[model samples]
Target chain A: MKVKVRVVPDGRHLEVEAGVKALDLLKLAGMNSESGVVLVNGRPVTEDYRIREGDEVTVVRVLSGG
Target chain B: MAKCSICGGPAVAYIRYQRRYLCDRHFVEYVESKIRRAISRYKMIRQGYRVLVPVSGGKDSATVLTALSKLSREFGFEVVALHIDLGIGDYSVKSKEASIKAANKLGVPLIVVSVKEITGYTIPELARKARRPVCSVCGLVKRYIINLVAVELGADAVALGHNADDLAVYSMKSFITQDLSNISKLGPKTESIKGLAVGRIRPLYEVYEKESYLYALLTETPFLHEECPNVDFSSMENRLKVHINSLEEEKPGVKITMLRNMAKRIRDYPKPQLPISRCRHCGLLSSGDECSFCRLTKRITGQPLGPRAREVVRSLVASLQLAPRQDSAYKS
Candidate 1:
């Protein structure tokens, strides 16, 4: 039960337990410093979104400046 | 598992209002097509016109630039960019570099303008000297500099990165303050004012914050992840943002609904015409005796703009006036 996660642009990827949340995966990959929208399989999900086996996740920043 | 409404692929994002899940590729197409529709629906872009997009090396602006660049190929319009260096040490340097990288990636020409060089005072210096908040001063400087740059470049329109969240916050604040006069100003494209040579466009007006960020990431657009050192997250906007996020969590697509209503109200508002007067100091059109920027600079500098400064500003205004009146189509 391993899930594949990749952070775009950074091209960083990792495998984590299927039960892990998106935030947990990001933290494990050392890419959790900034705030971003986590996408699982092709849809945006909350950080608490559970990662199913074979799920592909991407973390993208969502903040805007004036 | 949810399926993409269009492709029947693995859906990555769920659009509550549309009541459908979108796969990564379909989501990208959805966002880009939405941008295209918003632009044409609002007449944000015109044929044979140059648009000035201010890039701050942030995800939102970068996404706007990338989208516009992609559209420019088929639309037959030019997209140029302006990046302001406020001289805030590493923040400014890194932000400028990111803007340069994004502009280069998009293959668009970018002009980097320095506040200290043009105004004789860096943002930090002016913030320390002015009684107003640092964010206010920074906003003033950025608007003034970008507007001047747009005019100098003969741009027909100035595009900002404000998205659905930003407009929603603006509406919330305006509602609380009971200031309805500004409501008409919130929309996809603003009418060209008498004084300014160019109108303004919010191409990302309907796009959500998360969607824009994801667009930037998936497109590999270079942008800064750092916030301004002087920014106050406790400000009214930030507070409203938190509140809005909570509400959005409870009911997705609330922001979009609010923005839609706001836009409709604006469209129904009666147009108000006012006489415009030139600011004596800068020779720019002003509703007051002196423009807000001039007054702010004077208050901070503690003196009239010297002859040289006056001449510089006057020349800039003169050049702006000489630019072609390309935004006449949108004029109210």
Candidate 2:
């Protein structure tokens, strides 16, 4: 029950447990749902979206500027 | 996968505020509609007008340029893009390239101005020489350059890319700091004063930052995704943005509602009409005998570089080869 998670701009990669909500996945990667969006297989999904086994998850940071 | 609210198609996004899911095509339409509504609500553009869009190679600015370019023909206006190369190392280089790509894709004429060439100092250099923070120096330089270029080009309005989240956070910060006058300037549009400042319009006024990013990505608009190297993540504004977005997570559409309410009551907090005059050095708007740009340059360079900067921008504008107006592009 492991999924691949990749964060954009920072280019970080992590392996997290499947069935975790997208929001929780972001938290595990040291990001907040408020500042970024979660995409499953290149399509944006809500924070409540649950990851599946072997799913490719990407987190794109939206909050920018100083 | 979620289904599009309007059609039984695979959805790309779920707009919590609207309680609807939208496929890729529908999402683009929704964003464009919001842009059109903001323009109509503010009466931002008019027929036979030229708009100067200053692009910074960021998602917000890219989204603004793309939307405006599509609507320009329909709205009976021309769009010209301006990209100021602040010379922040590779960041500036990438920014200029993205600006060029976006402008080329839209077939909009673009003017490029190099701060280093005009002032003999990059933004960071100027900040060090002037003993001011980099962000402060950059802001002053951009404001002066934008206004100068817009005035010289005879642009009727300058389209900015400040999205809903940015404006809301700015308004809240201004309120907390008791900067009521600044809050007065935070609406969808600001009118131009003859011989002084050109009108400013925010086409992305109703669009959120996240939505802007998504639109830019889905539309394949070229933009630099990297944050400026000078960003201070610990700053109050960044903290405020996080807090504001957290509130939005709980209550969808709060940002838009708050901004709309603020716009409704904006005139109640009118900024005092300060006595404005032309800067003797550059012949642009100034509050005192000299504009802040001129004063800052004079302090750092031993002479006011405002006049030189204006001349540089003028020549850049003059050299632009604008495309022929294509009225047919707007035909429905």
Per-residue lDDT for A57 in model 1? 74
TM-score of chain A of each: 0.71, 0.87
Candidates 1 onward: DockQ, in order: 0.22, 0.60
Candidate 1 C-alpha lDDT tens digits along B1-332: 56778888866666766777787788778889989988887788877778889999888899899999999877888888879888888989999999999999888877777778666888888888886777788897787777666655667789999988888888778768876666677777776655554678999888988788777767788988677777676778777876786677667778878876777678675444555766777655466777677887778776544233445544644543443544443333
For model 1, residues A7-27, the per-residue Cα lDDT tens digits are 654566777788887667656
Segments of candidate 1 deviating more than 4 angstroms? A1-18, A21-36, A39-49, A52-61, B1-3, B8-11, B195-197, B267-275, B302-332
Clashes by residue pair, model 2: none
Looking at model 2 chain B, report the run of 10 residues with the lowest lDDT sum. B323-332
CA lDDT for candidate 1: 0.74
Give the TM-score of candidate 2 (chain A).
Answer: 0.87
Query: How close to the true structure is residue B168 of candidate 1, measured as C-alpha lDDT?
Result: 85
